[model samples]
Target: MTGTAGSSRSILEGRGERSGRRSGGTRTLLIGLVADPGFATEIAHRLAEELPGALAERSGYRLHCRVTVVSETLSRGEGERIIDLAAQRRAREGWDFVVCLTDLPLSANQGYLVGDLSRRANAAVVSVPALDMLRPAEQARDIVVRLILEWAGELPADSGDQEIEGGGVGVRSGVQPVAPTDEDIDVEYAAPAGRLRLLVGMVRVNRPWRLVWGLRNAVAAGLASAAFGLVSSVVWQLSGAMSALRLGIATVASLAMIVLWLILNHNLWQHADRRDRVEYRQVRLYNAATMLTLVIGCGVAYVVLLAGSLATGWFVVVPQVLSAVIGHPAHVSDYLRLAWLVSSIGTIGGALGSGLESEDSVRTATYGSRERHRPPREPQHT
Candidate 1:
């Protein structure tokens, strides 16, 4: 009876081992190192030595593991092929866990390709900062080994347990709260030109209220220029004796008013309060468009005035009409009407154009939020 009992126990133990191996429930790890030449082989070697023991000590589960060093110089398509090959091998051999360690910036095109490959290969990809070859190699190996052990059920899920607190076997809770750091605060300042920078500073100080101020300031400036230009033109037309000199003064004044109007409108657009930092490129583009619209508005106003005069026949009829009606002299009623018409057209067109351009600038700034703003490339080694 004693012999039969021992035989039954032995049979159960052997079956359990066979089942574990066949089903890949037994701890197994495959590590792939995709990095620059100098650090790749070193990581593979260290992972081979450390991972198996880590699994045993942490979870009491023995492991079968293999590590491979791959080159970073592989083309993107070639990299995908390599990853597919690795996945096929893992599926065929029934690998329980796969890990990829890379020492490349994750935002680069090459890095993105490798990341896609790792995902398809059913691997957790960890990026190691490539400050130095030897240092990152050690770091990569440690991280990859820890990750493999954790995934293969060789490490506890709750890393906070005092007993396994510093065993280097488990992952910490990924749910820890994060606080905003200095890097998160983006304050971009555009140097003051004319009056725009001052307006931008004021808007920053007041926040949302600044948008109201910006709109009011833009409209006020545009109207002020139109008013001054109209008054100057009327004064020149009425003073027939000194018309040439008065017209010269009027022209100079009109030009000054237009320049001031442009300066104020531009500043208002740029200074408008934004919750996020202004993108300099987009702002510049918007500014260019605004300037173009200003010029177009002024040209349109001049053309409209000429067309109004032709339609009214002011030159032929003005003197006779004034002699009969006012008893002395009057230039023409159409002059004031034409001035108002021109100003109204220009103002409306400029406002609509400015608003559309500003909307485009805002859209571009928002869309570019996810993009990494890389400075001009300094020459790279590889």
Candidate 2:
């Protein structure tokens, strides 16, 4: 109970330091993680971060475990290939367990698979994309733990220690442990979803940054910037017309439009159940996050526009051009007006950027949705 799961912070650094001191005497387990680059790296880091804490609780020998990514992704039907490669490399570069993670959706027998392990090969592959949960990293961690346990024969094959909702199947082995009472069985098998929720709760205990960058928020922001640029000119003119109040109005107007666009099209609250629709409080939270993201994106766009305008103004503001355009040397007010004008337009472009991005991209970029509640699957042969 003392080593119970709670925090998901990166224990690698601290644990590595401690483990290094004991390496001379302690046995070491090297885990190879092959993952697709982008989001898979996040999962790998999360796994590394949580592994020490999660494993500390399990009864085991005092061994040092080091997790390394294979620097490549494996596609469907590539698990065995990776395993073979790992085996080949094992002679020179040894690994105790090799787990491959891919962002690609994977299925077996037309059923989804979050991950699968083969004890004979001491290798495993996890489909990060197929994992549906608010905190997928923790689920991935749990699967890895079970796989390790099963491989070590720490738990019986029929222990039913691991479970996933939707269509994922758990690894099984021939080893058997003592039978549990009917009540214990019920408690074990009946708690799949509950355990998953608890794991997520544990993973997210103090992590708030996940919400900001969970989905490809960076890509969304880029798309927003692009979209804002498209209609930026028109918005700039309208703002210019309000010359006296242009600066204040332009900033507010642009930020508002970008936030509105995200809320409407980002599917931030598209719950599967009508009753599960976000409440007013949740709505406020989502809006606040959206506002923050949009403001940052829009601000970047504004700065770029301002810089470009300043460069253009500097390069083209000869005496003749100034005489023709303003009948005076371009002043600070002129530059300020130009900056305000372009920022207003960029705001609209940011909205356009959101629309330009595919729905899937947007979905991949946001983390406020609860789609991870999708039914889990029973595991099948890959």
Candidate 3:
């Protein structure tokens, strides 16, 4: 009877310990999603919906996602150090881990960084430009999840650390794993960032389509140029005489001219820190993004002009008049040729019209939020 009573007391003690654990609940890991304004913000907002659930499923931990959906440009003397910016926020917020999403190009020493991970601080920076533009949010989710899992010791020890020629086994190819270069960083993915991919991403982040409205003056001037060409017999003859190849070249040249005019007129290029390789690459990246934004803006202008010219030509220009100039009956091809030629001519007017736009207008249209926050690039006084 004494033995039976002792066993009953032990069961009560076991029940009490289990109840105590139930009251405590599972430990919650805090994950911060800090993004630069624009696409990065969009990605963060998107991930916030699924990240907690996804991380919990993948890492077997309860997760609380904290999203900062604006520009977190940490000011430093050398300007924004992406890694430091992320690490500081992680420490300040007391988050178990942080993942910074940014469209700004991240340079690592001499090479470009695809991912910058500081295991010690439990923070990482994912350069959105380095990921494939198609479905970047999904790619970012995968990367962020893996990094968190690796840091939490949930992933296998050998799974994510080995460096391969193009990439680590599970990570994206052409983005090789990196050993820590910075004192604060523990793991990194530094590769020759695909220049075209980076440029495209930068253009996407700049949201050049916004320029369509921003350059109202440019559009107005282009429409005026197209209107004049439609009424002119000389323009009709010239457009008809031009071959398809010539029309394509003219389109490219005119677009280039407008892009150049905007860059030179507004002083949009980043001029500082060209002597150091890292600074040179960064400046080059920003300049390239600037050029691309203008090119895309011009490209949109050209399309608008082309469409307007075609519509105007159809309604205003008599078919018989165009046939008389080219010494052949006007066909659909003739109309296209005329529209193409007129659009090229119109884009030049856009170049001139762009001059009327304020520097702030051009600057805002051409740069991402990070660059927008920066003072305009100035000339070296030396």
Candidate 4:
């Protein structure tokens, strides 16, 4: 639309209504924050609180920005176009502009995409996973404001933070212009850093912290094993004799064992034959995200086990009894070592006990499972 001279463009000069004026009075323009469930919806809710004031401040009070969140998963249609979906939603819901927030990792020009704006349709798509994991809500807010301003031709051309390539089909920072077949007037992306950020965002969306709750049985079994190990004289002597390096190795091995167990047992690893390079990368990102989520989830579980073991060992074990078993005086270091060793053993035990969890339950910790279950609405494109 931007390439076509005087083509259909929306919200001319920050007035979101079709006409440039609203009865010569400030009109409340609706900005829809369409988000996928989970992390995307959470972020959208956060955005709604501050976005109106933000839009007013950024636009110099040129338009009254009112945000409304629509929690729904927007899926890909033929040729990977999502603007059609946004346009349909915008029209159906009577929103002047729409910003679809999705945790799904989007690719453009064979790399990572931050978001895209269609001037004519007044709809944009922002991949929440493409943002930095640190304060992603703030980042999304800034990006949304920038996209809206860019659509309305109100943002200055000199803003060095981002600039549309050829003022047409690409975002800055190593993103190339869209091909002739692509309809997006402008798109945003990150280059070398996009992969890591996207991965982090996807993991966040999966809410790996919830995995600790999901693995309650694993925790129970781990604690039971750890309780038993605390009383074992052989464990006491072995922990005192083991070096720190060996203890560290044990910790890693235990965590890895459970991570691998969860992946294999739940079938979290994604597999597909994608001919397109972009699709292949997407699949790889999903697998990487799954691995990352499980690692984090297991890591949290391990930490909880370690803390519990430390507290239990501190209170339960008598220094005199431990010294008698280890043939030396039990010091604070000895107690620490005991906790470390016990936690590791308990993690391994938890891996075994993980069988108590159903595949459906374990799948909650994986990105692949979430994607598989995300409902895709039928195409409403004309």
Candidate 5:
């Protein structure tokens, strides 16, 4: 299989080179427009119409650029899939360069996505703020054309020589430079670092809450398991022959409930990215801490219940750590008490942890200290 894969790759590379040569030296430019779906489509449409004409006039190159608009909301895997498709097409047909344009600021994950794709696909990546899309069509056209020219090695290296005509009469030339907005840039660059800090802070602030929540989940799961076990034991007592069937049904139901709980929890955590940008490692640590706290809470609750049972002289309903070994059955009430106590503690701890994580994320997301606006020094104190 590996040999076949290697041979296929060799064939593809050879074909890709041949395709590049067959295009009559008219390099195929793959322009990837990633942004808000609605905005990206609009910008792409304008580019499709205006670019060829603008480039033909400005650079004197009949540039055949193909613009492919990809919405940035796609998952990282999905984005890679799209890039793979583009590369395959390029290799078969022919492409000179791939340029990616995004309406997101460079400081955002979306901005990072563009950079990632640029490096992976060996394409030029450009980021433009969404607000800039509101500029006049001609103005937008100019920026796009200029960017394309720059990528194609047609634009002058220095900024001084570049001029845009018809500025005042609504043909806004060079209105908004082709650069990411300050806000977008700030978020893109600051978010990951900020998120990490936020996660750490949350761990500190919400440790108690997380401990509580973990206890709660653990107790709930344990009670459910114990109940199923008790019910199975009762079935065995009532009907010796049919006990196995009854026990099987109870086991299946318990398993189903556990599976459902797990699925719901997984979904909630998966979609919580917008809330805290929580990654897998952070979530794993949180779950571990929570479960440990739950166990501790349950142990404490068991001791309390045992003390109460002993003082009340309720010998009929005794809390036993191991029913079979002690020859004393565990009471349902004791299990209920433990479950509720543990769950409450776990919930509290989880909430606290999540909040702290969010705050830490925000703090860390902010880039290097804002430039302090210092008052100019008074002329020499002579």
Candidate 6:
């Protein structure tokens, strides 16, 4: 009985220790992330998940983050106003910090800004599109975490401290160098022209997936081309007659037709002004990504056409039929030739299909979001 009692006492002691550890006080931080509509929302959500874990690990604080995606486009001109408005919202919503994420390319003194922070308001603005990698969520989260860490004075001294208008040291919040003034409505940050282009170069190196757009168009074009080629093959009676060079030429021709159609029909080649070197580079990168995706899409269409032709020949084109039609016995090679011929014709069909796609649809398919929705420029008065 004494042994059992001692064992029970030991179990209770262990339970008490566990309870004490579990009840340890942990600081709770509430963060609000505001994102522009569309793909930015997804990135915001991912940041919400990733930021809290990273912050908790780094600062030993229990962090809670929420994302609010807004439909109104964020403009550089309206940045301060937005930050102030976010501050107001924070007061009502009980958010300790708020950051607005946008896709619009922002510039100030011709340099790009990754984000801006207001120590007084405990708020910030982050340009999601300006970030150079495909994983915007991770990068945005890191930027926000760095801002929070700076605010908390938890970073190392060598980490480039920032001095803001409010006489507070800021970390690498990615804000412009322009100091804030008394006017709350003034735009405090500016990204230079070439910064965005530089980001594109980084994206090309680190994350090329960000540049991929218009998958639906590519798929539609490929399918249409394959179908067209299949029908043409049936009509022309060209089964089992194509050589390797002929097949290769057919594939190349089909891809070329689709690419040419897209270039002629869409604004894929539009660029920023000539004087703005950075914007030009951005436009060039965009065009390069579009063309690369287009080529890949055309290639998919060719493969589909070939597969369909082979399947059709195997199931429908009998040996007897081949002997009668082409004066030769049907074989696997005959089916392959049929498929190759059909894919070539399908490429032309893809061109026709390209015309049917709307400009808006193509843009949506190619780019997750429109460049910017700035107000129309007023007519210049001489």
> What lDDT does the true structure give each of the candidates?
0.37, 0.48, 0.71, 0.76, 0.37, 0.56
| Order of the predicted models by TM-score, top scorer first | 4, 3, 6, 2, 5, 1
TM-score of each candidate structure, all chains considered together = 0.30, 0.43, 0.79, 0.84, 0.32, 0.62
Off by over 4 Å in 1: 1-36, 68-74, 77-96, 107-121, 130-138, 160-382
The runs of at least 3 residues in candidate 4 whose Cα sits more than 4 Å from the true structure, single-residue gaps closed, are 1-25, 75-80, 156-181, 184-194, 274-276, 358-361, 376-382
Candidate 3 structure quality by residue, lDDT tens digits, 1-382: 2443354233323434331233223334567888876677888888888777777676555333444444554444344466666777777875557788877777665356667766656678888777656666776776677676555545544555553222322345555566666786656765565678778877887788878877889889998998898888899989988888999999999898888887787777667665787667767778878877887877887888899999889888888988888899999888888888989988888889988987666766665334656644343377
Q: For candidate 1, write residues 64-116 as lDDT tens digits.
A: 55555554422233224333444554555445334444333232221111122
Candidate 5 lDDT over 130-206, as tens digits, reads 22223434544655565455444454445423355423011232133223343212111111223333333223322
**Model 6, position 40: C-alpha lDDT score:** 63
Which structure among the candidates has the greatest TM-score?
Answer: 4
Tens digit of per-residue lDDT, candidate 2, span 1-382 = 1121111112212345432345444435677777655577678878887665555444254444777765553322322344444444433455666777755433232234455555445566665644545546766776666555445444333446444331123433111122223221101111122323332322232133332333234334544453453234443344334565757776778767765776587665533344644344334333344344445544554566556555654454443444344445556665556556655565566566656555544443333432232123333578
Give the local distance difference test score of model 4: 0.76
What is the per-residue lDDT of model 4 for residues 1-382, given as tens digits with 9 covering 90 to 100?
A: 3333133233443544443545444445678889987788999999899888877777677656778898877766545557668887898987788998877776665456667788778888878777656667876777787777666655655553544322312252333423323555554544334577678878888898888988989989999999999999999989999999999999999999998887788777888777777567778988998998888888999889989999999999998999999898989999999999999999999998887897666775677777676566565678
For candidate 3, what is the TM-score?
0.79
Query: Model 3, which residues run further than 4 Å from truth?
Result: 1-25, 61-68, 71-76, 87-96, 119-122, 161-172, 192-194, 272-274, 324-327, 364-382
Worst lDDT run of 10 residues, candidate 5, spans: 365-374
lDDT ranking from best candidate downward: 4, 3, 6, 2, 1, 5
Q: What are the clash counts of all predictions, listed in order?
A: 0, 25, 0, 0, 29, 14
RMSD of 2: 13.3
